[model samples]
Target: MTRFYWRKYRSLGVVTTLAILYLIVRAKNYEHKAFVFLANVHPSEPWEFVADFSNMKYLNPTIIDFNLLDESGDYVHWKYSLEYSEKLSHWPHSYNTAVAHFNIKASPKKDSYFIHSTHKTCLLFGLYCLNSVSEFKFSHGNSSKGASCEEHIQYQCPTVLSSFCRREVVYQRKAIMNNLFKKFDGRKF
Candidate 1:
């Protein structure tokens, strides 16, 4: 009689262990969001990565910033910001921000909205997510290697453009950087 009870208890313990493990794994899997890359380009060419705007890894906590400039070169005109954790079914469904301007002198009167978000990290990170979302509205369009990316890249204009105008300048800069950080292999963008 004791042996029988021992066998039954052992079996129950095994089953409970398995159940707990299954639940742990399931919960872990649920925390990860999978997404494919937006571009399949040669690593040597950054432009290739931006060719297809639709190809992006969805991400979480999308970064949004909108700023409007007035004629006096002042940021006093307007601003709006939106953040999203998911791209589809628009989790937190209704989010909209608006800024109004009453100034007349803003030359090229500019209002820009920028987003940096993702559902995943690494290649499926913020860069790919932003490009994908930007192109979502214009999928029925051209097939350029970096048209969409280039357009977005334009927005990321350097705080200094003249410094990047020449190839020799860039080469020299990178060579110097390599020499400076040659010991750091784990340093990634």
Candidate 2:
């Protein structure tokens, strides 16, 4: 009876191992692009929110701590709060903070303001293999609150080894839009 149980358990273990191996082997790099619209936000609002790393909390709620590591003209390097390692028990142990770099541009185009951002790589958070770019355009409009605007955001991620974190991107996008459209859209920053 003990031998029979042992065999059953061994087979189960082997199957689980095979499944993990299959996932690892089948993991292919991919690229994803998506767009979203934010209503009631001014044309210049999103650009101002992202111009400084100090304002990251306006977009990503999970970030508890943010520190600027380096900065230069059109480039920024920072370590933002992350919990990927804690949540992924199988992931290799490393630093808890995720380091990210971005190249940003803010442009004025007559009736709209465009903010272009490209993410190079993020280390120690399973994002080192991915490259991302985002463009935000805010169009000015008329509203009862004096001046209102719509935000159009385009997001693209390339060379993703796994789709596990794709949903996180979507969530972040929605969070940013939600924050941007909140009651306080005219506050001075």
lDDT of 1 at 14: 100
Candidate 1 Cα misplacement greater than 4 A, ranges? 27-47, 50-189
TM match of model 2 to true structure: 0.51
Model 2 global lDDT (CA atoms, 0 to 1)? 0.48
Q: How many pairs in model 2 have backbone atoms within 3 A of each other, for residues 3 or more apart or on separate chains, i.e. clashes? A: 0
Model 2 Cα shift for residue 1 (angstroms): 35
Residues 1-189, model 1: lDDT tens digits: 999999999999999999876553331111111111123222212222212122112111222333433223233222222232222123234333322222211113222112222212112243221111111111101332211111111111122322322232234224322322232221222
Off by over 4 Å in 2: 1-41, 73-97, 108-110, 120-128, 141-163, 183-189
Q: Which pairs of residues have clashing backbones in candidate 1? A: 38-55, 58-119, 59-118, 59-119, 60-118, 60-119, 71-105, 71-106
lDDT of 1: 0.26
On residues 1-189, what C-alpha lDDT tens digit does candidate 2 reach at each position? 999999999999999999886665443334444333444555455555665556666555655565565666632222232222112222334323444554444343444555555454344555443345555554444442322333333333332334444665556665665665563445322
lDDT per model, in order? 0.26, 0.48
Give the root-mean-square deviation of each candidate in angstroms.
19.5, 8.4
